[model samples]
Target: MRTRFAPSPTGPLHLGHAYSVLLAHDMAQAAGGTFLLRIEDIDQSRARPEWEALIYEDLRWLGLDWEAPVMRQSERLPAYRAALETLWSRGLLYPCSCTRRDIQDAVSAPQEGAEPSVGPDGLVYPGTCRPEAPPQGPMPDRAVLRLDMARALSVLDAPLRHEETGRGPGGETGQIAIPGDSLLRAAGDVVLARRDMGTSYHLSVVVDDAEQRVSHVVRGEDLFEATPIHVLLQRLLGFTSPIYHHHRLIRDAAGKRLAKRDDARAIRTYRDEGLTPADIRAKVGL
Candidate 1:
């Protein structure tokens, strides 16, 4: 059993982060498994050296330790590009030139009481820039790459499903089978690589999890809707899907999800207020 706490070094570690990292550490310790830390600094535009240092300080202050030689995403562009090349060779990926405004305008409705459908990744892409057929030459540069979901599913033989060791926000559990059409509707032509960043979260995460040999994935429940996207990518890439454990989210008094911008609930702020590790565990009901 292997688990990881992959946090982006773009902001302070908050109560929600504390609950997640502590839970992952405790779970690994109980099972006598290895606990790993990976810094998700892929968005280098906002990632900072100071924030990365503070992540280490906060985790240590929370009475937790992880294996050395932590992985950082910024250093793995070649791996991501390699995966994209594989998908591109199979005609499962294509370059998309649609901007967010273009997608919204295409999918938006003019009639009253009708709003554009929203999917896991904001507005569902309307395939405005999707080519009628796969390109003949090499993959293009400086353009967003999107997966051809219909073509991808058509190439698969077996049914796509994953084990759920933890509950979802909607009580979805057990072996969840994902239908091809459902994925097409829910996450239509999801981006595999962005213009600025070579790889999107969906592509990078599944690759990293498989490379790390992670048997279980522990994360917030809000990401539950995106699990099928990862599962499909795993299938397309010939990787096994890990047991997903989506835990309850730590929210504020108004029942809103905690944001990284909310510094009042940051772990460093609590530490400055003289709170102990035990106090944090109790506060998060761990």
Candidate 2:
């Protein structure tokens, strides 16, 4: 029943973040399980030390407690590298040198006026770099490592299941079992590691959760589609699959989910404006 709240220290915490952290903490406390905090600061370009310090200050002000010293992703580069090498050795990875324009052109030009659909990863990659073998010899600059989707799917015929128990947005309690096909489609050849950072979100998150021995994963429902991919990665890397709970997101008055850019909703701003932790809990209807 152990659960974790993993927030990237790239921006100030917002109401959306508070909902996620409080949800995870409440779930763990209800089950008498451990609650852990993880700092997902892999995006070095955007992550800042001041933002990280704000995360600690805000979470503490919210009355949340983690089981151990925070786990930082930047300090775990060797783990990511080892996992990447394993995937490379298995021929499950290939280097992609295509830029965003190249992917868009490949998709739009082939199908006349076809509207592009967003996958779990935001952009549905046109598979422009789905090659037969790893690009021979050495890797090039500005390249990213993409998983071989078809090859990975061939090894995962059975339906993967990760259980979740929570009240839906409408106050209905239910459980969900993620299917394998959804995983394949939503996570189509996602980037495992970018040349700039040495690791991507999918790779770093799965590796960190496993290393932390997390028993339950609770996050916003927007990430429900990515669950299958995490399940698949756990299986491929021989890591244990933790239970998952995808809760509804906290939205603004316009019914739009909050983003890091919504400075007005930043938790630090709320705290500075004299909003208490109880005020935050009530705002999110927790």
Candidate 3:
């Protein structure tokens, strides 16, 4: 059994992050499985050397250790490109030049009194750049790429499903069946590549999990809605879907979810205030 705690080094490690890491690590250790750490530094624009270093420090301070030679997403660009190339060859991907404003305008253009539907990626894309026919030439170099959700589903030989070892926000559990029609209407054409990063979260995450040979995916329930997207990508890329465990999130006093911007709850701040690792565990109700 292999589990990973993947965190983006764009900000300080907060209590929310600490709870996730600790839970994942404890679960792996109890089952005698390998626990791995991954640095999701694909967003080079926001990733910082100091924050990366601080992540290491904070993890160590929490009295936990992971496998040697951690994986970094920035070094796996070639693999992501290869996966994109495969999808492109199969006519499952298309170039999208529509910006957020363009999508907003298109979504609002629907009939009056129609409230735009929101997807996991915030405001479902209206498919402005979707081609009526799949392009034949090589994939575009500079334009963002989106998966044709309808076409992708129609090509599937079998129904898509995933094992949910943990409960979803709505208390969904057991073997979850992915309804294709729901995904088509809800997710729309999701992005695979961005102009700045060359790869988006959904694309990189599935590829990374498969490459890492992760058997179980332990993450926040906030990502539970996006699991179907990952499972779809896994099937398209011919990768095995890992067992998903979407744990509860660590929220604030006002019942709001924590964010990276909340430095007051950062582990670094707590450490500076003389909190011990056990103290952290008790604080988070471990």
Q: By TM-score, who's the top model here?
A: 3
Please provide, for model 1 over 181-271, each residue's C-alpha lDDT reduced to its tens digit, 9 standing for 90 to 100: 8888888899999999899899999899998888889999899889999999998898989899989999999998998999999999999
lDDT of 2 by residue, 151-241 (tens): 8767765656666665434443344555556655556788988988898888999999999999989888887777777888888888988
Clashing residue pairs in candidate 2 are none
> 1 or 3, which is superior by TM-score?
3
- lDDT per residue (tens digit) for residues 1-286 in model 3: 8899999999999999998999889989999999999999999999999999999999999998988899999999889999999999999999987878988888898577888989899999988888998888988886799999989998999999999988899998899999998898778899999988889999999999998899999999999879999999999999999999999889999999999999999999999999999999998889
Clashing pairs in 1: none
Rank order (by lDDT, best first): 3, 1, 2
C-alpha TM-scores of all predictions? 0.97, 0.90, 0.98
Candidate 2 TM-score, C-alpha based? 0.90
Q: Where is model 3 poorest over a 10-residue stretch in terms of lDDT?
A: 108-117
By lDDT, who's the top model here? Answer: 3
* Superior by lDDT: candidate 1 or candidate 2: 1
Report the number of clashing residue pairs per model. 0, 0, 0
lDDT (Cα atoms) of all candidates against the true structure: 0.90, 0.83, 0.92
